[model samples]
Target: MASRILAISGGKGGTGKSTVAVNLAILLAENYDLVMADLDVEDPNDHILLGVQLQNEKPINIMLPFVRYDDCIKCGVCGEVCDTGAMLISPNGLPYVIPRLCSGCMSCYFACPTKAIVRGERTIGYTYETLVQLDGRSFRLVTGVLREGEEHTPPAVIAAKERALLTDGDFYLIDTSAGTSNSVATAMDGSKLVLAVTEPTPLGLHDLELILQLTSKMGIETWVIMNRSGLGPEDEHDRVVRNYGSRIVARIPYSKRIVESYVKGRPIVLLDPSSKEASMFRELASMVKEVME
Candidate 1:
């Protein structure tokens, strides 16, 4: 059977999206086979929060334009077709490729009439598959880590998601990066449901709307999770979610225990299953299980 994907995303940073994802995965794995894919290549920390090292690293390679200077035809077509300005024509009438600026779109490759652009390889990131055993059950964790100084993230995100999907599982939970970039969209593609985590602050409210809009357009069922609920007024947050035709499904109140558990690299669900935060995760897992059935 194909895996049912559930995406956990947040439009703004520091919204506890990963925390929700890790905890829910642990709870869900108890009843069903689950594979969690951490697609936040820019700053992936799901493995960190799960307290497991990433294993089985595989490099993600993309097409890097290698100009065959010997072919020697600089018609400026390569530079003109470059969308990211990665292709530059020097004063000497030669096309130079800026490795960092290239998005690997390969627009210049086909546009070059001289056929000087040859296909080369560049390593932008790596993907890892780790087996996380907690309690008596185990789930696979696929993580994507972008190479330092690499700006392109969509490739790495897609790579990680694909790696997770290859495994046989009943549920495929994806943890996306903060924000509504193409990278995030790539990570959330083909999800059965999306849980958008947000706080009550003004900044959180602002980005929550962006994520809701993206999910709405994708025609995915979305549920808002109010994290740190008592920090600020949620009148506007509630209004915005309702406007998007979605409702808040869970609320994780501010608590010092959650903070300490996070600091110690232990999820509240595992640290103290009897805690309020752990109960919230259990309730969320129940709702997700209903959807799965």
Candidate 2:
């Protein structure tokens, strides 16, 4: 059978999206084979939070344009047509490239009349794969890490997602970056469902609609997981979710146990299966199983 993907995402950061993803992955892995991928390329810390070292590193490289200075012509066309401003025409009429500014869209390469542009590669980030286990049951974790100072993240997200697909699993859970940017969309794309994690604060409520709008457009099954639920007014959050045609599937209350478990790199579900948070994850996993069925 093909893998069923569940995307854990939200527009606000610090909402415990990764925590939910990791714990839920542990719970789900017990029954269904699981591969959890962290697509938050700008700052991926799932391995850190899970307290496991990332292994099997694969480079995610982007195209960079190298100018051949020896070429006879110093046309400014490449500079003018460049979308990311990576190509620049010097005062001496020679075209040079700023590698960091490049988006690798290849517009400058096609626009160069002198054929002076040579394709080069720059490592934007890396994709890593590792195995984690709960009891005897094990699941794979694929993480995307963007190199420091890299601004473009969509390529890294795509690369990590593709690597995750290479693994065998009955289900795939993707943890996406905050906000509804192109990078988030890229990571959450093709999900069987998007389980959005959010807080009950006004900021969380405010950003909730943005992600809903994106998922609603994609026509994916959507669920809201209110992380730190009951910390603030949930009525507004519910109203916003109902307006978007999604329902609240689960709520995790604020607790110090969760904090300590996160800091200790142990999933709450594994720490205390009888705990409310652990049970909540099991409940969520059951719902996912039903959906897949």
Candidate 3:
């Protein structure tokens, strides 16, 4: 059978999405095989949260255009079709490529009427696979890390997700970047269920609606995981979830123990299995298992 994909996402940053993901993975792995994918790309920290180092590194490269001046007929067609302005016309009427700005769409390569554009490649990021073992139980962790200066994130997100899907497992749990952008959508694709993590703040509620909008449009069943529930009033958040036809699956209360575990690179479920936070994650994992069954 194919793996059932479950995505954890939020529209705003610092919403404890990764915190929920890693803890849930530890709990769920106890019974069923799980492959946890950290598709944030820009800053994937699931491996860090699991206290594991990434292995099996692989590069994510995209198509680059190289101008061959020898066969040049500077028709300026490449520049005209370049959406990102990666193809720049020089003072002498020759086209050159700005590597950093290139999205590797290959529009410049095909638009060159003179066939002066040659194919090249550029590495935007890398993907990694790590085996995390704790108390003799393990799950495969796939992570995507973007280069510091790279702005192209969708490709890396897609690459990492693809890598995760290739691994065999009973459940594929994805932790996406914080936003409703294309990169986040790419990670959420094919998800059986999406848990949109949010806080109780006004900013959190505002962004929660945005992510719910995307998930609703995608026709995926979404559930709200209200992190830091006691920080502020969540009456508005409750109404917003009802408006979107989704329900709150779990509410993780703010606690100093959770913070300490996170700071120490240990999941609360493992650091303090008897804690309330750990129990919440265990219950969440049970819900996921029921869905998979």
Better TM-score candidate (1, 2): 1
lDDT of 2: 0.87
TM-scores of the models, in the order given: 0.98, 0.96, 0.97
What's the CA error at residue 87 for candidate 3, in Å? Answer: 1.0
Residue lDDT tens for model 2, 1-293: 24488899976668899898888888788788899899988878788777789999999988998888787287688988987778878899998888888888888788878788888999988999999865777889999998999888888898999999889888898999998999998888888889998999988987788899999998888999999987888999999999998999998899888998987888788777799888888889998989976
For every model shown, the clashing-pair count is 0, 0, 0
Error of 2 at 277 (Å): 1.2
Residue 184 alpha-carbon offset, candidate 2, angstroms: 0.6
Kindly report which residue stretches of model 1 are placed more than 4 angstroms away from their true locations once superposed. Answer: 1-3
In angstroms, the error of model 1 at 248 is 0.5
Choose the strongest candidate by lDDT. Answer: 1
TM-score, prediction 1: 0.98
**Model 1: per-residue lDDT, tens digit, 67-104?**
99988587889999898989999999999999999989
- What is each predicted model's overall lDDT from 0 to 1? 0.92, 0.87, 0.91
Ranking by TM-score: 1, 3, 2
